[model samples]
Target chain A: MKKINRRQLLQGMVTGAGCVAAASMFGSAAFAADTRIRHFWWGNPSRDERTYKVIDLFKNANPGFDVAGETIGWGDYWTKMATQTAGKNMADLVQMDYRFLFEYVHRGALLPLDEYFGKTLHLEDFDKSAIAGGMVDGKLYALNIGSNSQVMIYNKRLFAEAGIEFDPIKWNQAEQMDIAKKLSASTPKGVHGIDDATMNPIVWEAWTQQRGKTFYADGKVQAVAADLESFWEYWKEMRESGAAPSADVSVANLGFKMTESGIVTGATAMSQFWSNQIVGVQSLMKDEIGAAMLAHKKGGMPGQFIKPSMFMALTRDTKNPELATKYMNAWVNDPAQTAILGLERGVPASSKVRAALEPNLTVSEKVSVDYFNAIQSSVGPLPPPPPKGAGEVNAAFIRMGTNVILGRISIKDGAAEFIDEASSIVERAS
Target chain B: MRKFFVRNLPGYAFLTPWLLGFFLLALGPMLISLYLSFTKWDMVGDPQWVGLAQYEYMFLKDKRFWQSLDVTFTYVILAVPARLAFALMIAIVLDKGIRKIGIYRALYYLPSILGASIAIAILWREIFNIDGVVNAVLINFGIQGPNWIGNPDTSLYTLVVLAMWQFGSPMLIFLAGLRNIPTELYEAAEIDAASKAKQFFSITLPLLAPVLFFNIILQTIEAFKTFSSAFIISNGDGSPADSLLFFTIYLFNEAFTYFRMGYASALAWTLLIIIGLFTAVSFYTSKYWVYYENERD
Candidate 1:
């Protein structure tokens, strides 16, 4: 080999250094590009618009990261999520429902977030209870995005016309029945008094809780048979007295939103709904709509609680777990995002965010906040995740209730049949 | 050997795509499902071996299974025969001298093309709703009708009527069978002083037996798998006391809604066996009834 000159050596060193610098630049660029995170949520166009705006803000704040947002309707949400997770192709961040959080967590489909929150996320400023709702087996697998409590909504015009003083906070079953009857009696033809949904699990849970009983204990239904019997009996009497819609009408109304419900559509006076659904109900009503407490049983515990309405979770299959956590934290903590989201996902769980949004809140948002706050003290703990096969159980309740109303089965027989069927579903799932 | 392979490469190439599709798409999933039927799975956790338990639950314990079977059989019995008979009758009418034959044929075939679709099923619900056009027409005729879609007593019959109305495919098949019958034979029968009804029973019925059997088998299988109309109209609950609880609907609820994949797989196998048995019975009985002109005997 020939001897190398000092100039050639210096030149070689400079070229090597330049190449290393360029390679590092390209590597960092690829790392930034590969850091793209996807978040999946279930909502309508309004929610999608709000969520996309939030994602854009998140992207702006975290300049080195890319974010993608996906949304599906509520009905198809779980099916798509479950299919994707089972295939190990889940999105980085997901909007989860409490109803399915336990199932998903138990199946190891969710990544535990305790490490992420305490170490990586550093979300000490966030409300602890909002973070606690995601805990399972001493590990947090989700973070609460918002909260909600159920309420009874009534048509103010119809109530005033019927000369019924609707005070759900203090109303017992008898009082509710009386009001229902009076409203039905005084209302003009073609309008019903109440549009009750027997299939709503929230109603069933509330009924069970008012009796100081649990829907499930030791993985079995523990409520007294008479409690359920009485619930069916109350509705039966309502139907027979024409205080509620007929069986045919009730069946026809199944699966419809509150907006399409007879109560909001000027066909009935009252109905039970979530506080967040007030807008949907208000949109369909020609008159003012007001919220009231969930009607309680006489001398029974007010069985209601502000449950973590919805959660943002990281799927176990996520390729970028830390990035997903960062995105979720940003989405929940960001003030502007919370403002746009408002109380649609329910009231904001982050105290800071709620305080930030409260001053500029709309009338509807105020109504939701006031409704939830007013009932906050009276609300009971969230009932345990509904039993497996809960959908079938709910359907069975509707069918059995319809049978009773249609005189195909007696109320007593229908009650027994419904319990037996639902209990069997629980037992089979176990 | 290389020369031989290369010489037949085009033939093998032609078969390769179908073979690949079968192995990858159809056969692979089918085999997996077969294995899954013998295991307990929730589509989330790993499947556990529980051989025959799913089948045992389905055959021995599930009341819903029997209810679904009854509903499916009722639908098959009502829909398949009615559809075939109506199709044959229309085919006979169209075979006769008629004006605008093509228009009538197209008009009658429209429903069959749209029969198994979601939109048409939704339309069916609207047309049969409490205040739907059917009741409106009934009111015009000075008659009051009960809520057809809401009443359990009549909901299944409404579906039966809907199925009967979609006789287009079978009608076209019957029409083809009718046209295949030499016109000279009908003319000779007419010359022999045979009445139209007698000629139909003696000539058209015998000749159309093979096509009728084919239509019955196909329609019966379709009826057993009916889901969309029942699901949409019943709001996915098989409402009104499970009057419209078709087999596939129940199977789907079990698998997805309830997360009982093993049980659903077993139900699928049971349905397969039922269809197989029904088809076998039809083939066995066909010897006594169906006549093929090309039969050696």
Candidate 2:
């Protein structure tokens, strides 16, 4: 009798476990029928959480449509995207950067959104410049999420301590150097006045633009070697004068976040960041931080231009383009969604949405929005989207800058090498 | 054939999964990649047969290709021997009158399992950063440490140390090799008044040469294929003037970042050849040193 009881128990256990497995398998199958499209983007944890919330809102609003979101860290986003593109298995909705837009669009990996502008996407409220920034070869391959420009973000506490009256818009090349030197002289040991921008392509782009040349144009690097040489020489002098951190520290902090940035760490008085990044930086610091324009060149043209923070692109192979388009529309146009996403991507590219969110704006958001508004007339026209091989050229620019900063290569030689390498890359790419 | 299939049915069944995986996954991609090496494939477009152009570019024009090779070679030369030597030392020490050998062995082997993990690589980056724990400790001692991961001069060395830190597997193998040596041989040398150092040089080393040969080949191949540590350390761009640009990192960048898949494929094939040559060289050199127990004169 006991043996029979044991046999019954064993049978019951097996049946129960099998039923549970079968139920879960079928349960997921039912859920899978909800037209679930995959979305991919890169962001810090906070942005990821907010994005997921926005995705949830989209899902809730439209039953039977779902976006299964995937987020990789900033460092790994590109390599993963390339692999997915090669496999012809890209996510339906992808976050795109302007620098990378031309490459993807030219490869036909992106869907042209022009056909859907009136039919599915309602872009009436978006600023013309924001929409224009996403256009390539007359086809709208992406839609701008927001607009931003590079701004000089400084530690206000450090400036106040150094007794310098900082006016970022008026501070050109000479004033910046003088302030950097003054701050460096007054700061404690191990602290520098400015973070190094010697190797940053963004700064070089502005510098070259100020000199009436684009860093890259017409599918080639247009900046003259003499200009790059002067830029390097200027930065080199700054380093030598104890105005910036040593090359090693600068290299370490390259692409670092606020926590490790010289501005937040009190190792430097000033650094450059995108206008939208102020809130993120402030969140990580106890110090009072302020934003300013990247210093203009002495006797040079206006170089600053607002750029799309990022774009929402639909992959060419997406099985659910309409739903994806709807999701993207909600992302850029929905007031509630915009409120939640509020300048995380950047100040809203949609004028309607920006105006709607104005009444509920936090002080920090107002500051960024006001700054972008105030700088409108002063900034230059947006340059064309970087062409193919621009990624390699940008990397080479940084590397040559490092070589100059480290004293490994003379400024003249570095500039010459950069021009040769960048020209070849661009030529081959074209 | 029917009889053979019936007789070896269980064996074939056991091998089927791996066989299916090999043909479907590994072999298919490898074959495609080999074909791709001769083409100008941007991965998103049609692959154009450019026959030897990618190879020509890699060999003659790409400065980064040569730089990555130099970095990888330096890493392999330094890391493999240091790792093996450290493994051997620990194995010998553990072989001597040590207590709780099982626990000690497990403790020592933990890093080998964790070494290649992304978490560990991240931890390593933090440990070597300018404001990291190493510098924090150095500051306490009034010694300002160089930016280990930032400074190009010291970046590769930090990666080498990371490679050396995961010597547990080799150490375990060496321990087994040490145990297998006949106790009688060491006793005989001792009876003949051989000192410990002399005994180690003559009897122990000669017996250990085969083990050493095996380890050198394996570790050399491994060191060549190391990607994750360098990739994570350099943030995938091999920054700080490309000092940490390993061969694989360069290959990955060419293929993905630069959209030069065909060129990257050529680089992959070239690396395979280089590894093959190193293995062959090691085998050729082994004849002079390696001694088999069964092959006495």
Candidate 3:
């Protein structure tokens, strides 16, 4: 056997390393050989199943065109999207949130759909307002997939136990308290009357809107500190009246996940909720749940507005714009594909799709659909897309609410802190 | 030059992969992040140079930046010394002639091995939650415990106690240091009628200074970079008024959640400076108390 010298060994090692790097490049090429246009969305398991079925339908109709779907939970979705966008490796199709739509579009992360409206995209069956939901700078960027509104969900069994004449449609804030007090007095010891989310974003946005105040405008939060103070006072009334649970109980269940939520566990009579979440909440409970608009002051302006639950967008990095747009159109407009999707995302944005699904709707879906249609008479216009740092502001709002409800800080100091943090976030982002 | 190149060619060739990785992966991104610290880039867009703006904002204007620093400093102060002290005490107790000590060492070191994991962080949350085991045990004693992880005043201490409990690494180091002491010295001190406490203060502590200093520097740096446990325990946003908002968590949120890459780069650089300063101070002060065994005067 011949012994290799040091120079020969070094040469061999370098050659080996080069071969490994070359192999990896070829490996990456092999990985990309499956030329499926990918669709990415943030959703739960049920929505994931619906999405995959619709993608299969699209693939079946258009043979030789394969599409892959990826789903992540809501919290980590944006983080993944940002990293992908930075690397210029975004999915072909992205599910867009309203708060992020304008930011993404302004940065040229999404392709504008205006150029393809008559060519490959069809939206004649959509309401003008529904079509306008994804409009940024007066041009279409994202296409609205579904519409939802702020809603309050209450246990029907508890309402019946109280035996009160309840009309959530016309009920003022005072009436809400009266119903809550009655519910609290009649309910058993452990079950509180309502969730301790008086100042939650789901409630705070509605409250701010009812006062005719925009939650955000021109990179600034429009509501003054006093507006937040009043929001605190309104909820403090409920807490002081023994209607909402204590701070520790509230903190323990900070989120609305099915596993530990107050409403699902029968620890609260009512929960601050969204129209899109009705089916989700009902899936966890055996007791019947009812849905309606949130509390409003006497003669206050309507704050509840229908919002696009999510939008479908062709990413700027998409390989084939025409084909991606066709897939998106089929996902929303094709009757069979839409039926397969059902109302898993939320209420359909297309009137034709809603008409097609009405016959096959389940009882709980019907209740949610009814709630969606009933609120339109009093529903406000769609809110403008939020500024860049609006997501941080959301966390700040929750933290401030926790501070107030938990009695860590006074409402005034909490408001000041929130405003300071919120303003700095927006200011720095722009 | 040719002769030098020829002589060192094999050594250089042997280090080729590491050198390539160092230059490409680590140093390249570091230099870019340093440049990014001077610009304004939201991940999707091209970075626009805005010299000194990010650093200026971080120092003078950013409230959360200061808050993160305050929280991290408090954690380092509370956790590092307490952990070292606890580890030393355990090491001293274990150094005595006890049977089956190897099993005890492994058992005590188990938490350090598995403690910095996401599963343990989740368990930490369960232990400090309102109805958690801590409160459950407190209830048996008829004493109602405040929500340790929920309240801002006490939330950080749960993280500190977690830091203290992972004292296994330093305890192992201390045990080795204890074993290295010459038994003859202790016997001589005993003949001189020196008390055990006196011998410990004079011999054990002074002899262990170098190891203790090494542990202090290592532990302090580790404490400053505490991320996953705090991030997971606080549910990623440092809730309950940002009390658990470690500097690394804030930097992560800035870079990823807000996509403020420019500012996050500045934050990362500041943290590097902080860790550098801490290590430098430890080294600078070591000459005063950390005595070597065979140093010539």
Candidate 4:
């Protein structure tokens, strides 16, 4: 090696780094003319593939229009979104969740879509209630792509093997519990009849709805100690009766991948799924998956309600606002686009699109649509979007719920702690 | 001053990149985080000054903070010593005359080379999964294995076992240290008819004290910073009643997951102090045990 001075080495290093950085900058600049608008959404592989296909369709129609699609598992989406928001690099189009919409809107992270409705977007065929769900302070900030409700999907093969009578409608929680106890007895060793719902907030929220109580109202916790105590007691019973799998089995099955879910892995016969996820859930397993309305109190109010499966929002940081709005319209209301997207997002929010696409839905897609429609009359109005600090409340719920399920804490104490923590978390954020 | 500058020009020039990097990246961010520890802010908005309230809450109220500390300490206490002992044992065995010693050393060091990778973390998760290899082996012995990764009682221990399995770097250090101990001493012990155990205690251990202490500090610090494997195995949020809630994982969650940047800053400072205290105490106590070959005094 030639003798090298320290100054010479430093100069070489600086030149090398400068060249690499300049190369990368030019590398992206080469494609800057493509008129790209990035879209970000969280979904399973099935929904993601359809989204990619739809993007391709749009690109083919509008020459030079480019979309870079980004997808993540549901758990990591908001973390990524929050980081992006802080950096002011949010994608042009965002698939938003109902719970986080209020926070994003309050922070002025999303654009109000009221201006885009008449020109770049036409949403006349969309449901009023679905649109209203995305409204905050009378300004439409997001457009619901589809409407979904909570549903219980069961393994029909497992039910058949156990010789249980299938009752898709008019069933009560008591009957479900009895079926849970009876079905587990007939299933194979270590396989439970019901998935563990102790840590799932949706199941608890549905129970609160069933009993004519709201879990959250006007950015304050409306759930009382009794609401949690009773809900936890039910799951505690579910676990003790061998109806639900043990915590270990449940945690293992709760892997980030959809394929590892309890129902898909044959760890449980019945599991909770959103009506929109029926097809995605079905795609993971070989068995025929069936879904029904969630069981409620025998004479209680309707527990399930139609809520936006997800919404497409235009980010405040978007460079191409008009193009983003046009894409949003295509995603939400365009019949041709819906033909490609189908019920993967949820049952279509637009009636015109739904009717046009119904005749062509796959077997699982039809099942989801039928289940969504069957509960139409009994379902409640769209729930108020979760208050700010809903994320903290949810994390606490899972942690405290895990404590109770694993016998680490008493039911009464766990419920009390959860309500207190959730209330405080909501209050603090406000 | 001109003469001084000219004489040191090359050295200063060589240091410019690292100096710039330190100021721009490491030291600058560290100072900002220290300031941020006194404020309450999500990353999206302007930071509001809370003035020690973040630290106050962490010290006085945060249950998860205590849980994370407890979990991390338990890991350090259990894993560091066990790892050191295993590495020392393996080093001693490998020090004996053996064919193809270089290959054996490389083979033994493979796990540590891959230890910090996400792939290994995922593989660890898979091996402890319900239908994974560990349970399969346990089944043959008519022993039903509890979910190692899921059960709170065993999850941290499984991570400790993983820590022990990757003792390659320390083992290599121990091998080098063992070589430095002259074979003449062992031969003298043999002439005295000292038992193998007696010779080890008298000759091997005391001679290896400095290296042992060095490995202890290295391994303990490494254990404190354990994040990736714990984060992966716990499925990110420290599930099954927060049993796998390592301190670093909790700090990450507070920062990113909950958007509690201010509290997270306080947590980062607290961890720094804790690791600093541990290192200081280790050095303080090392005087009693560590035997240096050269005595300055």
Candidate 5:
């Protein structure tokens, strides 16, 4: 055997190392190609299982792309996303909320979808209002996943027991109170007529909107005092009449999730929630829970609106912007995918998707869809974007409610404080 | 000098790791924070220079800042003395020959190690909840209990009690200080017909003054910076009308929840200055009370 020259030996070693590196890189790429796109949505196990089945169907239909599903609890979703975004590591696709979309978009952490769905994502086929909800400053930040409306859920058994023949659609404060009083009188031990929500800002906003007032005007709070005072008076009456739970019970109930909600758990006969949450509440109850238009005063403008429940946006930080847009488009537009998702995120915004899912829907899903449809013509205009420090404002609302419920403050005083605090928060944020 | 460097080169090399870490990790961040204190930042966009505007707003306009300061000072004033008294009493009790003294010592010391954690704070919330064990115990005695964690009037007091409960660390230090006092002094006092109380005031207290001083300073600082228990118990909202809103918790809210990083940084500097003033006052006052065993006057 003859010895090779030094140059030839060095060249041979280099070539061999390069070939090995290339082979490993090729192997990884091939492995990645075979793996499914990991999609995450915040939900409970039931929703997770359903989503997994949907992903399986997607993989089957689209052979080249496999999709993995992940679900987190709603509370942990934003926190996890914020941390992931800060670390410059995020899932391929995520369920996004309207509140957080601005945070992501402004931070350049989400991909805009102007080119993905036509030259600009066309609004002609979509409900213009719903499509507009997902746009920020004329740029499409997220694809509208679904639309939801607020509805009142009541126990039919409770209503029958109270002998209350109330039409929530046309009920005034006096009529609703009459029904509430009857229900309170007839409600058995360990149950109440209503699960009072003193902390719900949206409820106050809706009431005010019905009165032709808005929460904001000229970038300042416009309807805080009147809206808050009305809400406080309403809740105070309910509390005084034994229609709502005591302060302690109410606080504990506030901490409970949808499954453990007082209404669903039979502690109360009626509650207000987003239409999409109907199924989760119904699943926890033995009694049949039914939906109605949120109770309003007679001749009042219906303040209910079909707002985008949430959106799915591609992060700007994503290395594969085109891929992210394609994934979001698929999630939003694909009828097969929406059919499996159903009214889990309210009604799918895409008409085609909604139609596809409508035929095979469960009773609960149909109820939600019907609820939204009934109020479609009655809804007021979409609300403006909530100001920053909105969270602090909400907390302040809860605190004021606690004070009122505890009898530490009068309803009028609590209302005044809430308005003052909320306005201050808006001012600070501005 | 050249010979010394050659001989001590390995020793210097060994110290380099710690020296590098101190400058890079601790000192670097401290300087950065100082600079950040003067700027208005929200963690998203670039920081804006605001000079002393944040400080001015905090000192002049922010009612929450003053409220938090009052709460924190009240906590420090009550909690530090109460904690010291409890620790000193326990230390003296344990110093007496008792059965299973070591076991009692270890058992009492356990909470100090675990008390400051997030888990314990959550557990504290549960223990103080309306339907929790404390209420159950009260109810068993035919007594209805107030909502301890949910009541604004009693919420801060509950935290004060929690701080006082973790007296084991201070007690341990006091015990060591108690033991270090020369037995001869006590013995001489005993021969002189000195009462136990008298001996305590004359010998034990004087000798332990240094330790007591140290404990007061440390505990006051700890009480001032209390955040975890207040934050977790309040679910990070300073609930029931900001009753449990400690200074650091308020600072955290401004920094993270409200995204007022510049304001929070100014708050940080204010806290440092306050603590420095407190430490300075303690030192100045120590001359009148604290005794030094090693001093030659």
Candidate 6:
């Protein structure tokens, strides 16, 4: 048997502890070299697949770069992003939205990409307006992935069945409602004419813009109560006239996918969606679909504007921003990568990439391009980026609108409550 | 002190992991949250001291706060009693005289295991949708069913029914409690020519009171804290005019969705107080009904 004294035992324990401390320190340092930066974005499966392919191409292009990707559905994206933000573990490369980009930038979560525009990222080929949309307070914090405008997507078969042939750009709200009633009268028993868009903030934004005011300006709710009341009153009348689906149906399909929407499910003949959503809606249906501009306000201010489809940004705390920026460059600037992504993200922000991909574009994608070109000049100026706490305002709009359309509250009352609620929500953020 | 330390050394060593977790993960965050409840924290910036401002806003300025409280209280009040009563009824049925009761027990308990999941909530949404199974079934009987999860008036009841459907675990506990009741007492009642109803009123009610009390408290707290089903069903914004906004979902939205960490912390403490008050009330009232075998009520 071996005998051990206190000196020997103490010395052995100290050496072991020292060894563990050194191993842990060095182990983490080594782990950093092999760390695969995580990239997170929200998209449907098609976008997810294409993004993975682009990441693969990026890896091939830069052998030293390694990336792990996470894609969330649009509905769950913000929840995941916010939780990760709170935990200080946000993805290295984040796909941002115009509404959220300002909030993130204001929170110091996003790194300004302006300094790297020429050094690491190639912005020479990107559109001036596209680049402008990604700017916050004159500093570029994100890169526009694509450009998009809202479009009214109607089922062609439903339109033909209803004997309705209307030009999207020329149609006014009254004419649109008349067409909706015609379609509803001719459609199946359970079907309505138009999916309700009153709860959608985009519609309200357009409505507010038509009256020469924006929904939000200078971090405040800018629309007057009268404008809001008129917007709600019109929708309430539409619901009562059966030109749009009932409040119950709209509520049930709330936050649903294009595949599960009233238009695709044949419960409504027409629905309005972002231009990029056209392809996703097309994939789910055998029925032919047609695209048109949203009905303009009759003799009112311009109601349409081109906006960034989404933005690609770098998180401030990323370990490898250079590697991430290189990948972002490939995602938007590389012709080969851009072609694979196609119109899934909308028209490419890079004019060169757009021209290159236009010839090989699918028929549906061609429609989006033609629509974008047709409305490019007539559309209004882009509204200011949505303010912080804009999300709460959007929620309040949906809730109060539901109340009005469901006859639970008068339009005037709902409008008053909404202004009170929305203004406070915006003010609280500032 | 030395002798105590020596005697408890092995136990302390074994408890180290849990103790560390409790202090670092739970208690540490809890203390920070308590401090945060008195400040304004946006999660990305330094916290600002704004004593009682969050509470004042929640009570005086925020309509959704009061709305969520009403919704949660209504849910707990309705769901707990309905769930417990349903559980007790089934437990009595199973305990009285069933062969191969294990299969029946497992079948009944399945929903409890799966009920609170997001998948089940999605399934619930599908079943209650405008063109879903319930409405499809109703059509066959020449009756039009209102959209169950869409109409605000009816949406809450659907969630309540969901709560009642997961009564399996409470039922199992009641089963165990029923088994513990002595057969001799029933025999004695029978020998005295007591009626079945009379025996149940005299023996079963008093004996099973403790289990019922436990189930009531547990289920009430569970109902108050429900998030996934309400979240999934309402698509996380508690749409249809915020009818499905449970307290926890509202708190989550305030914290993660709105990034109002201090406000969320305040909401958390309010919920803690609400649950504590409810549990205390239940315990205080228990002496009126609950009876133990060895101790007097």
> Candidate 6: global Cα-lDDT?
0.82
lDDT tens digits, residue span B1-297, model 5: 999999999998999998796566556655666777789776556678989998888888787789889889888988889889999999999998789989999999999899988989988887887777899999989998887887877788888889889999999889888888879998899999999999999999988887787778778777877878888887676777777778888887776666676787788778877876776677778779977765556
Worst 10 residues of 4 chain A by lDDT: A19-28
Judge candidate 5 at residue A98 and give its lDDT: 71
On the 0 to 100 scale, the lDDT of residue A101 in model 4 is 88
Q: lDDT tens digits, residues B161-275, model 6?
A: 9999999999998999899888999999999999989988899988887677666766776787788899999888777789988888888888767878889888988887777
C-alpha DockQ of every model: 0.12, 0.22, 0.25, 0.29, 0.09, 0.25
Docking class of 6: acceptable
- Report the lDDT of model 2 for residue B66: 91
Q: Locate the minimum summed-lDDT window of 10 residues in model 1 chain B.
A: B22-31
Cα lDDT tens digits for candidate 6, A1-430:
1222324433543332221101000001112443467788998778999999988887887777688888988767887787677667788889899888988898899998877778889999878888899888889998889889988888899899889989877688888889989988888887888888778777888888989998888777888889888887787767778878877778777675676788888889888899988887887788888888888888988888999988888997688787778788888888789888998988888878888987887778877888888888678999988888887888888888777767788878888889988888888987
lDDT of residue A389 for candidate 4: 84
Candidate 4 backbone collisions, by pair: none
Fnat of candidate 2: 0.38
Off by over 4 Å in 4: A1-34, A188-190, A254-257
CA lDDT of each candidate? 0.76, 0.82, 0.82, 0.82, 0.74, 0.82
- For model 5, fnat equals 0.12
Estimate, for each residue in A1-430, the C-alpha lDDT of model 5 and write its tens digit.
Answer: 1222324433543332221101000001211332445566798777787778777766676677656566788755765565455445566677888766766677777766777667324444577777789898797777787788887789988998888787655567667667766788888876888877775666776887778777766556777575677777888788778887667766654343576466887878888888888887777778887887667756887677677887777664455555445556656666666666777876777777777777787877777777777777777777776666666777777777777777888877778777887788888776
Q: Model 5 lDDT vs. the true structure?
A: 0.74
Winner by DockQ: 4
Poorly placed runs, candidate 1 (over 4 Å): A1-33, A118-129, B1-6, B141-144
